[model samples]
Target: MAGGDPHALLAAAADQMGKPPEGTPRRPRVGVDLGTASCVLVVLDSSDEGDCPVWVESAGSGALQDGVVVDFARAVATVRALRDRAVDALGTELSTAATAYPPCIPVADARACTYVCETAGFEDVTLVDEVTAAQRTLEITDGVVVDVGGGSTGVGVFRDGRLERLDDRPGGGHHLDLVLAGALGVETGEAERFKRERPTDALPILTPGLHRIAESIRAMTRGTDADLPLHLAGGALMIPRAGDVLAQYLQRTVVTHPHALLITPLGIARSAP
Candidate 1:
């Protein structure tokens, strides 16, 4: 957990190994998240001035797909543009940074996220898994960290500060979009906006989809820590009733945070060395 070289970083702390953070004001560590639907960069300040996490910026483009860098040029340009914006806003050249990937993404894909940062001109790079990163920020010790983002859901089981198991698979908000698309006979994009704008009205319609995600979690962690608390992280579950749907299905306590979408990205920044 101390400042160490990149190789010294651990798998347990990978989620938050090198991303921006919350709570404590720490040195400005940058975190780049190459998400399926969006790419985000966050920087946290330790010694600067105010009590805050600095350098929170994100840009959405069809660059990365399902947590993989598809269009390399678009990914590079998106990250580069974000870096420039943060540099201009913070008045500091953010050369070194950390980034993260889905819990179950291959090591090569995880490294791809780190490369995205370095290609954008970061000198130092730390790699972390997305769910672990979320737990770092939430500090969930004996519980499940379920990250439902645009592309997938990552589940991490932790006890006594050690992650017991980690797994992830696709089927997130995007999947829900397909459901809505079929129901409403519209494009997935339109359903996404509909879910965001009218979630209260949309929850009933999306119940089956949300339950599907909940059931995925139930199947993955069926026997272990069945009673453990569930901390929700990511944007997909940000739907108003998603947590309750999970609670009803899982019969366990489910946690939701303000700005849940930033949970993993912010935790990734905290992973910085």
Candidate 2:
């Protein structure tokens, strides 16, 4: 397997997201991510550069918790809205999509993610694990891809571009919000805002939570190659210096990307057939 530069792919994805070209030779493929905090829709051209995102949009929804689709109807509605927005922006109908679930969830729960996309009107839906979806975007031949989302941290160990091991644990941005909320005497919503808008002030208060997440990674990747680098995806660790904090705690190289939150969603699109 050939290793491609994940940083370059992420940069291109960032640049192309939400800005589809006027006309292209191939139709666009779609990826839908039903995250605990939000639902994202990503579209990409089926051309050679399909790795780059063509259109992207997100909407906050409480249909999921810890990557499990709890409110089936709400999840379907959220995805429908996102798909409609992408179609309107690109002036193309999106009939097929790929979606993902965290690796820790039961197989039945994972199927809920696919159902949501299909219920939202997608004629064809592909299902993949969240960690594998992220790998599709990063193309990391040998490394650890960690997707720290609102409710869980999913780790995927890869060698020669094949997934060697995968695991996920509950503990992510939402847990950090709880820690910050307790420390600052604020609501969880306010804590989330503070963490994002004033990370410098919030990082100190949230370090312990970050460490917990790091420990989860350490536990999940226990038997994998110790020297492999760690690549970060998902939004929880999008805070400035979060990667540095993780590296310092785990004493391993950590690779972060611009628009880290979009990695899995874009990768899900890449999985579309």
Candidate 3:
């Protein structure tokens, strides 16, 4: 198991993006995240200390919507390209992988993620809900795990290292992009680029969208432990004050990990067999 402080694990994973670590990698595990905004592939090498990430890559290909495979061929192509690049960089063949989906989606839709990985050349594919995968990385024994992706927000409640509740709602970074586009009178694509390049300028415009996501979290986690801090995962709320807005709106403690975007992708890799 990758045992350590969750933030440290995330930072280590962030450090490994596109930069292979020293020495021969061992017990390589791969995770594929077919996000609405992009498809991310992560490969981790297992050791006595923990799982250290060796390779990380993302494609700007938008083939998924709300955690469902909307364009299977494009998703497959994107994953295959990531796999090829990782293979070339690591000098090893990755045969198995783990991927995730939103909790509210139908089972059939979740299976489509597996099919994409299989078609992308993985011999074995493991399927897990996006929230659970994030927990696998955060190891939140008694906190709420909120994964806000480009298309949806998935929530997981944990107690004593066990998941007590799991749910998701449709609203995330893509929704924020739409809001920003409307405010700036620009295309959604342009809004997305602006949000990424100039988040300081974009934060004020996206506050309502962030609040909507916070509302989704509040709704999904109504009955869970209210005292436990909300731990945010995924890339949607990585904007500077986004977490602050969530914390303020919800009136609950919010733990925003560094390299927030890679949390779920790294968790998916840890879930790989």
**Clashes per model (N, Cα, C within 3 A):** 19, 0, 0
**Candidate with better lDDT, 1 vs 2:** 2
Which residue runs of candidate 2 sit more than 4 Å off their true CA positions? 1-5, 16-21
lDDT of 1 by residue, 42-89 (tens): 776644232135557678866766677778888888999988877766
- Candidate achieving the largest lDDT: 3
Badly placed stretches (over 4 Å) of model 3 are 1-3, 20-23
**Candidate closer to the true structure by TM-score (higher is better), 2 or 3:** 3
Candidate 2 RMSD computed on C-alpha atoms after optimal superposition onto the true structure: 2.5
> Best candidate per TM-score, number?
3
**Candidate 1: regions farther than 4 A off:** 1-26, 47-51
TM-score of 2: 0.93
Give lDDT tens digits, candidate 3, residues 1-273.
345777777887777777764645679999999999888999888877888788889998789987888899999999999999898888888899999989979989999999999999999999888899999888888999999999998888999999888999999989999999999999999998999999999999898888888888999989776799999899988888888998999999999888989989988998999
- What local lDDT does model 2 show for residue 176? 92
